[model samples]
Target: MTWNIAHTAFPAEHRRFRAVVGGVDPDAIYRAVHEAGGFRSWDEPSRDLLHLRSTAIEVYRVGDRWVLAVNGPSVEAVREVLRLLGLGADRDVQELKGA
Candidate 1:
């Protein structure tokens, strides 16, 4: 399996982070976020703060990729979420060898 990960910083929004992952399984990403206590439902209302964590993260499907947005109080918090999700600044597609 091959996947692409990209990161974008929202400077206007206090440097909030948005990670766009493409060419991967959206369901897998959704499950990971759900297990990490993040919001997975799209029907929920959007607010200034949605999740309980200070670094509020939301995972949703967009086309063939999963868009993970982190809205936190600080850049460190947002980066931490990205790290936890295994998404880095590298946008190159990665391939799995065995599986």
Candidate 2:
């Protein structure tokens, strides 16, 4: 699923993390997400998600802006993501495109 994650800075709290649940090359997507800066991948995760939790990167923070580039048709999966991350309607999640 495609996500346009924007905040005022980079995310710090690990449990508050979000990630990709798609069928694309996450390695390449990982590289692309931070090209403009504001995010970085964590070498360790509290748990594993398809071997990606460890390598999954942080795209942005609550004080800045970043984005999640879904490799394929996981577009409708963003809500599940937010739920997984514990982010509620309280936080401002701006969907940049139409699914």
Q: Give the best candidate by TM-score.
A: 1
Clashes of 1: 0
67, model 2: CA deviation in Å? Answer: 15
The 0-to-1 C-alpha lDDT of every candidate, in the order given, reads 0.50, 0.34
CA error at residue 99 for candidate 1, angstroms: 42
Per-candidate count of clashing residue pairs (backbone under 3 Å): 0, 11
Instruction: Give the C-alpha miss distance for residue 82 in model 2, angstroms.
Output: 13
Report model 2's TM-score to 2 decimal places.
0.24
Q: After superposition, how far is residue 63 of candidate 2 from its true place, in Å?
A: 34
Model 1, span 24-95: residue lDDT tens: 444555555666777643543221222535665555556555555555565566555556566763433222
Q: All candidates' TM-scores?
A: 0.44, 0.24
Please tell me which predicted candidate would have the highest lDDT against the true structure.
1
Deviation of model 1 at 12, angstroms: 16
